[model samples]
Target: MITGPLCRAARALTELSREKLAALSGVDEHVIELFERRIAAPDANVVAMLKSTLEDMGAVFIPEDRRGAGVRLKFTASETKRIATLESEGGLIRGDDVP
Candidate 1:
């Protein structure tokens, strides 16, 4: 179940404005605003649509557990592949100094 905060966090993680999200999800912009503000509650179907839209835009909703619910941006396929290749290079590891 997605909560108001979770939806807002996911939207932020995905860098989507309410207008954009509503356009993509076929949800009303006002409804999104109300939901995020915790001023109103949409039906389960609306929540599902929002979640699906966010997920499609790379927002991954973390299930609630000991750490609690959260949202994160998922890496795209190319990024994942590049990361795997870089890791498999197996070169010497060193820490860089930050100034």
Candidate 2:
């Protein structure tokens, strides 16, 4: 199950607005907003719908465990290449070389 913070983070990472996510998930806009704000709890079906929609858009939900939960983008081939190039150009640290 995706937590409120994780859901919000996924939306931010995917550049998806509340309205956009509502439309894509077929859930109400207000429902999405309230859920993301942690003001309301959505039922299981609604949560599943949101998670499915986000997964389709490349957002991978990390399950809660001892390490805690989160979300991250499932990088595509182009994204992988772009990140590698950026790292090579000093936009990011190479390998585990960050100080």
What are the Cα lDDT values of the candidates?
A: 0.93, 0.88
lDDT of 2 by residue, 1-99 (tens): 787788889999899998899989999999888888899999999999999999888899887789988899999989999988977885644588558
Q: Which candidate is the best by lDDT?
A: 1
lDDT of 1 by residue, 1-99 (tens): 798899999999889999999999999999999999999999999999999999999999989999898889999999999999989898877799777
- Residue 93 error, candidate 2, Å: 23
Q: Cα miss at 31, model 2 (Å)? A: 0.3
Residue 79 in model 1: shift from native, Å? 0.7
Among these predicted structures, which one has the highest TM-score?
A: 1
C-alpha lDDT (0 to 100) for residue 41 of candidate 2: 93
Model 2 scores a TM of: 0.76
Error of 2 at 53 (Å): 0.6
| Model 1 spans > 4 angstroms off | 90-99
Alpha-carbon deviation at 54 in model 2, angstroms: 0.8
